[model samples]
Target chain A: MNITSVPFLFLFLPICLLFYYLIPNKKSLVLQNVFLLLVSLFFYAWGEPIRIFYLCILIVVNWLLGCFVDGKKGTKLGKWIVFIAVLINVGSLFVFKYLDFTLENIGFILGQELPLLGFTLPLGLSFFCFQAISYVVDIYRGKVKSTKNLLNASLYLSIFFKMTQGPIVQYNQFESQLISRKTTWTGFCDGFWRFAIGLAKKMLIASNIGYVVTDIFATDTASLPVVSAWLGCFAYMIQIFFDFAGYSDMAIGLGKMFGFEIPENFNYPYISTSVTGYWQRWHITLGAWFRDYMFYPLTLGPAIRMRKFLAKKKVNKNVAKFIQNLFVTGCIWFTTGIWHGATWNYVVWGLINGAFIIWELYKKPLKNKKLDSALGWLYTIAVAFFTKAIVCTPDMGSAFSYFGSMFGLNGNSLVSDTTLFYFREYWIFIVIGTLACFPIYTKIKEKLVNNSNNSKKVKTILYGIETVALLIVFIISIAYSFKNGYTAFIYQKF
Target chain B: MQEKIKEILGELLIGVDLSSKTLADDGYIDSLIVVNLVSELDLEFDIEIPFDALVNENFNSVEAIEALVKSLQK
Candidate 1:
């Protein structure tokens, strides 16, 4: 079920919370964890009952494999264990997520239709699979110890809050907290406040703008107006950020309510002037996961080892380093792309983003803040606008045609009534959405905190206003949800 | 020994000049730099650092790196 739905918001969460708090303290705290595991399983089974079985099987197998890897840490068995675990996890993902796409491509090439066994994808299959692989790999690499208990492992792999669209919290981040953590009044208040903010973001902001973007994306692009194309593209760009980040906020807030601290995913990524900076800020957990597991290993693997060997033969260190980085980064982005979806367009989007980031990193490192504020920032957003079309479109051909319309190619109108109509409908929201991308409120709060001239009276007044504002946002979000229905997050489909 | 590794890392990673203080904080060691550092150190010392050895404690400073290398050599 959608987390924001009426059933989930009013009935399911209340019942779950009631059961959770009713559990008493006991030996090993296993009782509380078991209650959570059962509740989480029920949560997963709500949307996809059959697929929930697959998730449980994955948890059990990965937990066993993790222990095996840990047991044989210093031997060849450890390496083989990791290889097998990765293969099983990734192979399942391929079968479920990519088999249909792969078969379609093969049919196109061979001029014969293959029997397509189209399987229904499980909810959070990619996320839980990635978590499983990361857990095994982290154990293999000695990054974290294997959790001794299976129930704890199950909870880690299948927790409902983060299961849907993850900030992709790593193994170690929650391991200790799983053992023991507190649920204090302050933490509960903060968690509720955070959840309210995310609810506002999704209910009030993302859903409204999402309607316009969806309409725009659905329109035929052959005769679409240039201004309308640009407007839709920019709207989609903002819509996606808020939609996914909003989910992340609620997940983390839920984590806080349960005395687990989930990491922040977005750091006002739109403010970043560089593509590299953008990656660092956006979906931070995903980036770090790739950096540690994918990028580092690939870079330090035979590719760089061979580069190092060549450098020993009097090759230029700089040249060899640059070539290796290019290769490794290409692979990282390609993986990142496919991880998002099964389509070729996602892959191309990844390559495009990868190309821009590499160019920025090598040609200029975005160190000059003064120059960045002038025109460089606009260039970054422009690149994202074009790239976002590839990401949001159904196929490559439609995406390029949309780009053509955006650039006033293919006999598309430069301006039209449709464009004006959209502007009339969406201007206020567009302004609010655009401004929300920057941390204006956060900056002012930081200023008040750091500035020495601020007094106790000022602090108290500001805090009071903030509390009242939060309550208003919370009430409004709930009201909106009741008036309208739930809107599924864009990233959760990935 | 620490000075030697420091010199190599400073030469290898581009952008800001790195020193003991910067290394200790590890504030500047992005993924790009870490890969290059591992390769260069592996080449210079002719000893492989395992994946587990990529921990913050080992890579946090010149001193930590020197100690790790010394132990690996033994």
Candidate 2:
């Protein structure tokens, strides 16, 4: 069930909170963890019960691997066992996520129909599977001690806060927080405020804009006006920011409420002045996870090699540096895109992003950094918007068609009959939605909160007003939830 | 040595001032600048810093940072 759904927000959360608070203070952590796990299992099993068994299998196998690695700590054979376990974990992901896509493409090229063993993708399979792989790898690397408690480890792997969408919490990061932490009254207040804000963003803004975007995009191309297409795409960009950002905010808020400080996932990304900066702010935890665990390690190898070569003056440092950087950057983006889904469009999206970033890096010697940042940001946003159009499309051919219409290159005139009609309908939402992406509201809230210290009366008045505003937003969001027939979370498909 | 470390910390902190009274005793460096400072120190010195390194026991004063840097240099 979506965190935004009525049952989740009104039913499950209230019940959980009531039980959580009722637990004796000393044993609260154990009680809270148990409640969260049972709820998490129900949450996952809500729509897809078949996938539940597979998830349990993963939990058991990975838990066993962690135990095995911990058991053979001093033995030389332990390393190889860890490797085999990790390989099997990763292998499962590779096959399930990529198998059909690979077979279909290969079959097309080889001029023969490959026997398609059709498989239904388990919900959040890719995300949780990666989480499991990271857990085992961390244990093997001695970054974290292997948990002897399988149930606690299982809870860590399938925690409700991130079971569906993820910041992909690390075992080490989680273990520290999960063991002993007291949730303060202040923390509960903070989490409640954050969750309420996210719910409002999703229900009021994102859901509304999404309707306009979906309406325009889902219409037949022949019936669609050119202006409508642009409007739809623009609306989509806004919808995605609020929808995903809202979800991430709620997840973080939920984590906070549960005494786990889930990392911030979005950081006013729309205001970023460069593509790299945008990536830094957007899906922040995911990007950092890949950078730390994937990109840095890959780059470090070549950097060390270059450091050695430079010590002897054996290689051209500049050339070696460029090649090393290019390879790492390429691989990072390739994985970044592929990690989103098993689609060629996603791969192309990654390549396109990598290419832009590489070009930005290439021109660094000649270009002014600030000017390049501004231009590069514009270029990146433009590229990203169009790439998202590709991502949103079902196939490559239609993506090309969409791209064609975007430029008015397919003999479509800007001032055509269709253009004016779309502009008339969606112009206001398109403009307003774009403005909401930055830190305006956050800045406003900060100002009020900062000024709350000036007077007791003033602080009370301000907080009371803010609470009322939040309550109104919550009510409106609930009202808007049924606009579409319970839109299962976008990240749940991952 | 402590003064030198404070100067470096000042440069790293940008608009914020680090004082003798506030630097170690109070929590003036609790927010954005601390994160940046921690990363810069780690990257500049090439050492893995446990999260606790930012707190009073070792990083409580400028002398602490300098001593930490000197030890790493060794």
Candidate 3:
């Protein structure tokens, strides 16, 4: 069911695209919307046949809740409705995703075993739940009105391109497109090129480097050499970015092909000079979601009240403000950490990011822009490189052991045979993947293709070359896809 | 009111230009700064800026902020 799989690329997508375009564009898109809804449901069912029913129930519940909130807008009932909607969305998420983790922790604390109810989390439960919450909350906020049409709501929640993984498009951002959109030949061609690029990134770069990362991480961390440990961490850092961002690009391109404009999820995050800047670029929609839905509400509502209370008690103004900021930042990072998984390592990873960002916020503003940026880049990369070890490891023990190896604290040698082997095998992939993380290729392509001074013949030749290049990339990616069988996107687990 | 708002912004965001048209959009004033600014404005004007008013347009520029405060006051 993965978009990169043979069946999806050769069969499902082609069939879906053919049928989707067969429907004529009219003033009303009910027929198209209905068709997409059915296709999306089928896509989800392909993987999680039983869970698709649960998804349908959630869609219906959220749709009704949205209508109710809209109907009761500006009333106490509206607030309560939105609250209940959040509870339902979050409650279901907790039951499916976090209940077992919670139970295990409780059992540990009590020194007794507890019977655990194991539930397989539905595909994209985290993403769809967030989308559902945003829909109801936006209705209550009057930012967007609820749609009376159930098909449109269902399509919004289960759109095949964004259902499993997302740029997490907000309801208000997508509501208009659901009503009316145009599918142009130019858009389709652009989308195909973008999809090809994403496929190449995933197949040619991430999948190739991922094998080395897996091999290194699987080795005994206590004996893992310094070079091998660092190589593993660095390779994982590259693997995750290309894996998730490539999937995002494919999703966005698919949306474009279908005449929908999904918001971008990444913005060359590695180029960022600070943790704060990095979050703003990476998983942009999720950060914006947390900011608007979680951060702002907590800060503006409770944090403000707390600050006022502290001010009345004669607390120093800066001290009070710092406390408020600290409280808000702590809450955000804790939730962000746990949201990634029910793992403690992810929790620590989130908190580490939060701590650095807070330090940056409170640190004295740098006066020299150039020097500050250089230092910031170094600081950011170092932090990211270390924290990525935590993300890639199974637990804190393994993470610490891995870190020990990385820093030569484990009596590990600086270079090992395994490290040399990995380098010899994957040097090209490592170099290309590292360079691809930046926007250098995009810049070069833009300069060559978009320079107005280029003659018409030259431009035509450039386009021809570009088309051939994309075709080659697409063919190679497909070959890799067939060889690999089913390489799931890393983000799909979340 | 404008002078008071300007003084507060200057204190919170030192060295940042106040005349820029897209302060929030351009990342000059991020979420942390917005939180600080909101608390300061709440204390200074004794006006609670509603959550819905926290959009980028309301805080993208000094003039936009002034207008938002003015309208909220009414």
Top lDDT prediction, candidate number: 3
Best by TM-score: 3
Q: Can you tell me the DockQ of model 3?
A: 0.65
Model 2: per-residue Cα lDDT over A244-284, one tens digit each = 88888888888778667888889887776656657767888
Q: After superposition, how far is residue A355 of candidate 3 from its true place, in Å?
A: 1.3
CAPRI class of candidate 2: incorrect
Q: List model 3 lDDT by residue over A299-387, tens digit each.
A: 87899999899989999998998898789988999899988988899999999998998787766667998888888888998888999
Docking class of predicted structure 3 = medium
Local distance difference test, per candidate? 0.81, 0.70, 0.89
lDDT for residue A163 in candidate 2, whole number 0-100 = 76
Candidate 1's displacement at residue A302, Å, is 2.4
Question: Which regions of candidate 3 are displaced past 4 Å?
Answer: A445-452, A455-461
- lDDT tens readout by residue for model 2, B1-74: 56656765775444345545356445334322343345445444665454334445455566667777677667
DockQ for each candidate?
A: 0.45, 0.07, 0.65
- The digit string of per-residue lDDT tens for model 1 on A351-398 reads 888888667655643576587554667777777878888887889999
Q: Candidate 1: where is the Cα deviation over 4 Å?
A: A25-28, A312-316, A364-369, A372-376, A452-454, B1-15, B23-27, B56-74
Better of 1 and 2 by lDDT: 1
In model 3 chain A, which range of ten residues has the least summed lDDT? A449-458
